[model samples]
Target: MKKILLLSACLSIIPGTTLAQNTTAGTIELDMPGHFQRQSVSFDYVRRDVMIPMRDGVKLHTVILVPKDARNAPILMTRTPYNADHMTSFASSGDMSSVLEGYDNMTDVIADGGYIRVVQDVRGKYRSEGRYVMNRPFRGPLNGTQVDHATDTWDTIEWLVHNTPESNGKVGIIGISYDGFTALTALFHPHPALKVSVPMNPMVDGWIGDDWFHNGAFREENLPYIYDQDATPKNDEKWWSNHYDAYDLYLNAVSAGALGKSRGMEQIGFFRQITAHLAYDSWWQNQAMDKLLVKEGLTVPTLLVHSLWDQEDSYGAVATWYALENVPTSARNLSIVIGPWNHGGERVEASKLGDIKFRADTGYYFRKKILEPFLAHYLKDSTISLPARVSEFRTGENIWETASKLPAPDCASECKALHLEPGHGLGFTIPGVDAGAAQYTSDPDHPVPYVPRPVLTKGVTGSPWKYWLVTDQRDVASRPDVLTFTSEILTKPLTIEGEPLVHLTASTTGTDGDFVVKLIDVFPDQVSAQPEMGGYQLMVSADILRGRYRKSFEHPEAIPANTPQLYKIALPFTNHTFLPGHKIMVQIQSSWFPLYDRNPQSYVDNIFFAPKAAYKPATISVDIRNSWIDLHTK
Candidate 1:
């Protein structure tokens, strides 16, 4: 009878049924993708490309996809700064009835044959009208007439509700990366119709986290595309370098200026901006989302989604979610869904990451159970139980866990210090472990690659970059420049949840340098079940720190030569279990190659403007004092 009821409930949701199913709260759907594609169930949503006027009179390009049969359907929207030129093809050709094979990837599961879906090109990008400021700051308490992203979102939501014929007088905004920032800005100045927003891997602070920068280091991924705007119409959209080993290309640049001036890389203007502000100063503070969130407080109910292994926005994901930490869990309108994904894992099949199989179709589960349900409950008033305030996926022990708060409030969780001992051993604190210090010379010419070069073939294959965190580290583990520390075999599984941090007591021979740290799980040397997995060293969590910014990110200063400095490299969010017989290892290095621009060991006012001559080798020593990683585990 229960099985029959569940099936009937699903059938009732099929359009044209009045069997009446509860949709306003708890729902458990059969996680079956095959059942959803019977007859293909292709649905037509009227596509309209119109100009949405912001309060300031700037017209923005917006795509309105309204389901023909579903009248008064709730509107779900995504606003992106990225080019929306392909969408324009929908209305321009007047072939609206023909299915959008590409866009349908999202429409299929999300639109579910019908929901008023809207996509808009944010101001200043593509065909949108208005000057685009990357990561426009949230204007606090707009004076009715003030204009900003906050007001733009509120105004757009208002216009959408009244203009879209079938809009149910309610709107929900969603975006990834930059668009995610726009969604977050909407919460600051919400419209009456704007009920909810999901900001996935949004930019939090330019100086610290997200795509452009990590802490104070400049991220090289987007630099190729957003280069000095020299990319003319005649030039293709291949933003990354053409060299087979772009990793080595950027590494050799030494300074941002060196890279910018050569090979037409100068067209990338942001390269100079990054070198100008090495600290979290006015340029970044004005746009920092964390500061805005603290002052404005997230008033609207929000769902934050990000992967534990998100290469770009793990910092933003965890920082944005925990920023609302002071707010009571019950009263908190902020909810999160952390999965074993890299970057946009929520959109992937979810079962496997590179060579690591998650043993489940994690992506399908997120889309069917989590993503679909959350959007439906809030936007369509479907009876569904939203995910817990904190929904985290546990890797190694593949399962999703929920609780009132993340880092689970359970007694089993706490910061257990994994101390570094002499002879490269990792264990709980011993009486006098400081036996002196571990030392190495970091040569700029021989910088360590963030991942094995063979794995970085995406540049040639044109495959999207993903899952670098899960890349096996056995190749670089034996490098002379990398400091490797290992713990004894675990007798029982050691499950950890939440952010892990590595605190190092070190000093560099030069005035400026970078410290790279990796938290790894080492499989036993001999594995009977899977010999291929033998000695597989998977990187769980890792981070890097610019030695100059040891004291403050906003006020970077040269490291006093030969002086022991404390560098705390806080890693990204992670949920994993170090199974019995497995070993826990932490590896420390100086450079991460082209993934991040190498730090010139010699400190100059701005590292980017430094000449090639400034690049030099330096000896780094990490002493045993209070140097250890604080792993939060259950």
Candidate 2:
């Protein structure tokens, strides 16, 4: 009888069903896929609005959805600042906006699987009471940040388990992007009911590396855009419409090869207001989840999901994962899944978004086969087995591989460093081969533009973009303003599984200079190939660091022109297993264009105020006495 009822409910939600109904709250309802019936399962659900209360005597607006028959079941929670109604309604309408939208009516799906679904608006956001605190979290009384989402989540869960009848008393949290950060925070003070967490592209660290900043260098183009879109009022579409217009203008300028010519300059004033507190002060430092993770530790199993091309939150995710894995804990279980997709590419093919062609339904396979099974096994305590170490989707090979540990190549330290000679572009040779250092002048006025790929900047829109094979630092090397370094081909596969550090003894002609290092997997042939598997790029990993922030993030000092200073910068970590017959390539450059704000050659109070006239071509000398990048290998 239960099976029959579920089947009927699912049938009512097929492509063309006249089952449209309106609720008192003006919510439009439509049936969604339900649980299995007979040979196959289906899911059907409904969406509604409800108010959630926080512990701080504040009411938060929320959107609630449940499987048509869900009662007395565990709850799968997602608290977000993004509009719940818009996300839910769009999911029901079948026009997928974000990855979370496809599962917007999660109530029905989880219920069909025997669980309840709940999505809430964080405090101070849309529909929620209490002043919205951006990334700032309230610590103690009113002494610290404005808001801490972890406490809000704890209160919300407490309210739902007690108020909402039929709850099985167990809760699992899942979210992407900012909401993903919220999901991570909930685990900080794991409720007795909280069992599992999936934080996808979570903003774990807000100050040093994130959408706002990268390697101490500010992401000039994207940061301002994000601030405008998120901070602006959304009562009407006025702010959003204007935001999109500006985005379009920026996009056009990028396409026309005129990057800084967009309306971004006009919005500089706004950017200053949003990020006025530039240094990693108390405001930004308070939001660093690494510190919080240590203070209020994790007590639940966590699945860290990320994409290699996640231009916004890639570094933060990697840093958070490493930090958590190191902390001693029995309750904390760390696992990672890295794909070749962009930020939202896991749900949709990147090619489709850019009118390119590729394999069909990459997103569906991951959701139904991988994600669903993981959630089901853990939440339901089913007899399904889970992989122990890593389950990665390799882009070049176009298949999934599981390993007890990250793959690494057999090699000695003596075979690691590759020298970048003055004339010879990039090739592997002994370290002390006397290959003179290359020089380049990074002018802030004409910063190098980020490599233009179709989907590199497609925010939240799951569009397939063209994937580049191995990154060719050739262009950067050929440019007079960039330096190229290469190592000899590895006789065997070389696996880099930990944080990469670049130790440099260098002197800059200016007060501050930027050092950008890209770890590339050089293919045997100049031309490499990418599979039609999905929108996966064939690059291994890359990172950058600012010289001023080398010694300390809080303090800044100028460098003596002729005197050498030992600057150590930690590049982003990677778990890549570089294949045999491939060479490890590293490119050292001072600029990455509008992706990061350029540093003026002059020693100024701020890079933003550095006049165009102050931008002068400066020479940078890198001493080889103790300059090298340490790669953790197997």
Candidate 3:
């Protein structure tokens, strides 16, 4: 009976009086319903809850918020897996900002622009009726089903433009993360009323670089998400950690698969898919949104928003931009805005990340200057001009740059090379003397923590993982198992506008291992402006790759023990400058524990099922003579 009540509470079953018997009256009375109908309240906007019918006769839960004086206003919509009711209800007052503070409403932009805001629960989520698939593949080779997110979005937009009498018949879709993925799908066969799309930090390709995996390494920290999100449609289930420190918890769990099994994740469909397709098989390839978008062609003006320090989906926005760069339609219709922010940070406060400060409220500026104008121009017929095809925030210089000054993606070919030379040094020219190798012992038993000790689970809101990308690198640089290569203080500013490629010829005593390379900017010893940040080691770009997948991401081959081989790790996109008096440094290590699963140094057929005994110590050596980094300069 207790379990039944708990389940009832979780499902939000209405409460009232239980069935009763009146023996004396010799008559029966029905259960009385709750008194919810008597409560009345007023809001600033007219809120309407409707279940819009899809092509397949499925009704998706949607909430529309229209301003009291709305007249022919454009509709700005976001279709989300996250519940629409919780996202749309923040206050009972007449202020739009108060009603939409938590979700990625871009409140000021919507409130001031007088746009009708619509939030909907995607099919199979919340109150929507259907089966839910994680990052549901398009209706093609991967998906044999007739209806997908694209079709659902089309049906929703069609309903909005026709049913909403106040709408001007122009619509724009905007969202972040999973919601962003849905927004990107709307561009597949865009409706005539769909005018523009803003996919902010979207999850494009899970196999290549996105939320699921990077290169060939799985993001084990995200396992909790799979449990919470896929356990049920309403997502009422929760994942609890036995240990407070994530490092200890993951270490004790032995392997991610074992941990997941202990948590009953084997029942989740998405978890099963993740385990079944560990490699970048056709399952992952066919669903890549970036590739799908290119194949379908860009039909609407799309603006991609990228965050320089985005902790999640960092590669999606930039990767999508590159994939669409050469497409004829993209040249004029695609625009990108890159800023210094965490995942979806552009929608909230963004003046600073971690210990670093940008000296201004960058989020407010972006919404007012970039997002608002872009929406108004395309959706409201405003004369405000949009930024260039590429608009990125230069970090150290702390200013925005448009396409006029943006350099090519691989301009490092023209700039001088930054080589990893002997005696822990980085120089413009290669070292003439032979430096044998830089060696370090990698022990899976005591792997390097991605962040400082006492690391908490990242699934919780406001966790340090949100800004862990910008955390000081000094913590790991001091460890003996890590290698640090530094350059002399810069006499002039060093600017880089694109990706940084790490090239290394390395060998390990075991057949498998992992390599993590970080490009960082070392602040000066003394700073006049901020004393706390003096000598801070800030990571500019970094990434990791599993050694077994060196030749190809889809295939796994064990490394020849003690034999030197070449490894190229491509870091994420960045637009930053190492100012004068600052130093440029690179750090290399084998593991980024708890964040990514430990690479059982020894060879294994499948890492997900690797045994505890398979994880052993290995000696990793980097041949300085053959190793160097190629930096794309401005």
Among these predictions, the greatest lDDT belongs to 3
Error of 1 at 204 (Å): 1.4
lDDT of 2 by residue, 103-161 (tens): 32332235346556677877766777876555646466323643367777888788877
lDDT of 1 by residue, 226-254 (tens): 55232432234455555567665676566
Candidate 2, poorest ten consecutive residues by summed lDDT: 91-100
**Model 1, position 39: C-alpha lDDT score:** 33
Q: Kindly indicate the candidate among 1 and 2 with the higher lDDT.
A: 1
Model 2 misses residue 381 by how many Å? 4.5
The TM-score between candidate 1 and the true structure equals 0.86
Q: Model 1 residue 453 lDDT?
A: 70
Q: In candidate 3, what are the lDDT values of residues 167-273, reduced to their tens digit?
A: 99999999999999998999998899999999999999887779988888889999989888999999999989888888998899999888899999999988888
Q: Each model's number of backbone clashes?
A: 13, 23, 1
Quick one: how many clashes does candidate 1 have?
13
Q: Quote each prediction's TM-score.
A: 0.86, 0.77, 0.93
Candidate 3 stretches greater than 4 Å from native: 1-42, 404-412, 459-462
Error of 2 at 599 (Å): 0.8
What are the lDDT figures for the candidates, one per model?
Answer: 0.74, 0.60, 0.88
Regions of model 2 farther than 4 Å from truth: 1-43, 91-114, 141-147, 233-274, 349-370, 393-415, 418-430, 452-475, 487-492, 524-538, 580-582, 624-626
Model 2 residue 211 CA deviation in Å: 1.7
**Ranked candidates, highest lDDT first:** 3, 1, 2
